[model samples]
Target chain A: MTSKQQDKDIHQYDIHQKKGFSSEEINAMSQSVLNEKLDNIDAVTLSRLHQARQQAVDAAVLRPSFLQRYWPDRCNLSRSDHPILQPLVLVGLIIFALGTGYLMSHTRTDQLNLGQGEYLANEDDLEVAEDLDFIAWLIEQDKVSDNHAG
Target chain B: MQAQQQRNHLDHFLARVERRAFHLAQLATGQTQPALDIVQDAMLTLSKKYAHKSPSEWGPLFHRILQNKIKDWYRHQSLSQRIIDWFGKKSSVRDEPDDVIQTAVDRQTPLPFERLKNEDLRQALNMAIEKLPRRQQQAFLLRHWEGFSVKQTARVMQCSEGSVKTHVSRATQFLKQQLEGFYHDQ
Candidate 1:
């Protein structure tokens, strides 16, 4: 036989020759030893240990550990409606609405009457009209005087 | 409750293995209390996580935990001692004097040496078994002491069957060499 085959044969023989417990003996001994161990271990200690372990597992299942619960805040939001952008958008819309309401009421005469509150015009408005009339009268008088001089 | 049955099974499994486990741990740690603690810690871990694991899985799992605990103990000791040594203080720790005296006495005391001499032979064999390298020791214990199959031993050792065969063969050869005097004198 080849050297490899010889080695294999020797390996096989060594195993065959090695002393080992028989299957029946092993089963009997294992069972007896296990039973003896169970008999000696404190039952109450074991029961309490079991209950505590179950409780821990239940807690983990109910609320995952910090590591398990983590989802990146950046990835959780999409472009349109992130929590950060929401408040600024709402404030901007309110400001825009207020500015538009003020401009619309100022431009309409009927709405301006309500803005005037039963008085026809405020002093600022009367001042602005008077200034316009003075400038126009000055221009007309200058035209007539220039005609007469010519 | 299903878990409870699994734990019960695990308790039984560990109980079956505890003695040899203690002996093996004792061989590695060279002390009883540390070995016992390691075995207990291993038992607790196995019962908690791998209780539902099979009988075939228990042997290796227990050993793995025991190995890890042993490593941790050594690591902690190394760091502590290194710190102490760095400060230039001589370690005041001493070996257990009682154990030394008891072993010395045991050396002189004869068992019913004539009638049950096989006990001596068994102990010699156990010592030789213990002296093997850790992997070989584990392979010997699992394959011979625990009566695991070669496949089961491989599974526990987390190695291929061929590696298991080599370890067991090397272990048996070493044991035979170590105990040849006892075996032949028998």
Candidate 2:
């Protein structure tokens, strides 16, 4: 039978088509036509789709880099597919990171200064500790003298 | 080893769905290139993120990604882009023939003359589909073309079940009206 007759046969089998307002497709005619369209996909396009699937599969198998993994938008280049915005975003992130690092280093320097201030505040205790050591030396000298005298 | 198995499973799934996905995108966009890009984008997304999900989950996820990409395309087209695509369509449809006869490889595949009758049906149906409103087209294609159940279509469309049913019913009525001649001619 011709494809038309075949399609008619398909329609005949579909009771849904008789309903005239079937929720489903007009039986399999359209779906089969669409499927035929798929079969007719040109080689170049088919190859391209195959290549796309390959690329996708490669992407699936080969792990994404840290950048692709964490920052997906950065990888897309299609925030509306501008592509120009990707570089801008990268530049923004770099500047932000540098600024954050600079601020962090400044805070660390301040903390170091605060630590030094605490040490300076303990200078009086250091002097007391030195005096205790000197007293200990004096006691030792006296004890030595007494032993010598005996 | 298990990762290899997972990759194989993913490859298998993508291969099975790729052609139909391409057709779905092509019909939605009414342009081949963006449709390819959209399908590729969808594939990339599904593989990248959802490959780890249950294989069964991939269908809805892929369709969602594809639908979202189509919506994104609709949102982003500049008028210049549309004009360019209009001109591009003429040259490409001529120069790079993605036509049925040119693409058919099997021995049993019909010649252009023999296929002419059905070609009218295909073109008419395609044009009718192209004329449909975006939501109706999407609803009909997903409901029938993609063979999704109402519930599944709703989930993919991110709409209520009632909304999906309504959309499908309206789309059905519209398509039946549009293709009335083609059916009658047969």
Candidate 3:
């Protein structure tokens, strides 16, 4: 028969077979036979299978670790390697330095102002200044009296 | 921790499918060593490349990989045979004595399935499956044995769904004819 006719025959037979037996029954039969074959595999092949499994597991373990998944260039710390983090760190350092310098300058200016104000307040001690002036006048009067006696 | 979980998941998937994968390869190649190699290669490739895929996707992905590996083996076999033929022609060897001896032995010996009159139905079924054409065997096994849907089988076979159905239909018809008595007795 021609190939096309043969194909048609096969298709017809396939339909007949399907109608004759349920698909579930055919599937179950084939599955049972295949399972039996799987169960009856030799020990040597089973050992080989175990070895293959272990090797596959090892290969998987050797793949990029979880850390590599998150930080792909973790091993490299160059600025070119970390485009985002490099600029962020640089900007952070600059901000911190500027903040520290501003704080120090402000604190020094406050200390200088406080020191000058305290010195001026001590110079403006009214009672002490008055006493000093009165003593100086008394000395002058005594000196004049001595000179007149001389 | 995540890597370990992925590995465990991959291991579980491989353990579940390796036997059936081996059987499929054996059916395709009709040899133990090549089937073993194919299964190992498929397992390793699936683990290394697709371990991060969801567990639900691993089944179809691994089957696809296994089928591709089988195809690769077929290509390699054909290429090597071509090389051998070229060398044989260069050496002006018209016929190898081994080929003649093998052909003689093959003509004398009965096929394994032909002796299945008193054998188990399972053996007869397996023999018949092994004797099927590559595409038909793949379709039958993948559809009936592995329980893949027609769409999934098409994806795995890299063929249209209609072609998958045709292959499966032809395979079922052939198998039905071969195992007619066995199924009838059942």
Which predicted model would earn the best lDDT? Answer: 3
TM-score of chain A of 2: 0.33
Under CAPRI classification, how is model 1 graded?
incorrect
- The residue-by-residue lDDT of candidate 3 on B1-186, one tens digit each, is 888887888888888998999999988887677889999999988878767656887787898899999999989887777898877843222122322321132243234332324357767777878889999899889898888999889878888899989998887777777766765565
Clashing pairs in 1: none
DockQ of 1: 0.03
Worst 10 residues of 3 chain A by lDDT: A71-80
Candidate 2 local lDDT, B4-23, one digit each (tens) = 88888888999999998888
What are the clashing pairs of model 3? none
Supply candidate 2's per-residue lDDT for B85: 88
> How well does candidate 3 score on lDDT at residue B104?
30
Would candidate 3 be rated incorrect, acceptable, medium or high by CAPRI criteria?
incorrect
- Across B61-174, the per-residue lDDT of candidate 1 in tens digits comes to 677676677667667767877898899976732243324422232333333322324556555555665567877777766676667788767756667899988987787667
> What C-alpha lDDT, on a 0 to 100 scale, does residue B42 get in candidate 1?
67
lDDT per residue (tens digit) for residues A87-144 in model 3: 6756887999999999999999998879645644775665676788899999999999
Against the true structure, candidate 2 reaches a TM-score of 0.62
What DockQ would you assign to candidate 2? 0.20
Candidate 1 scores an iRMS of 10.6
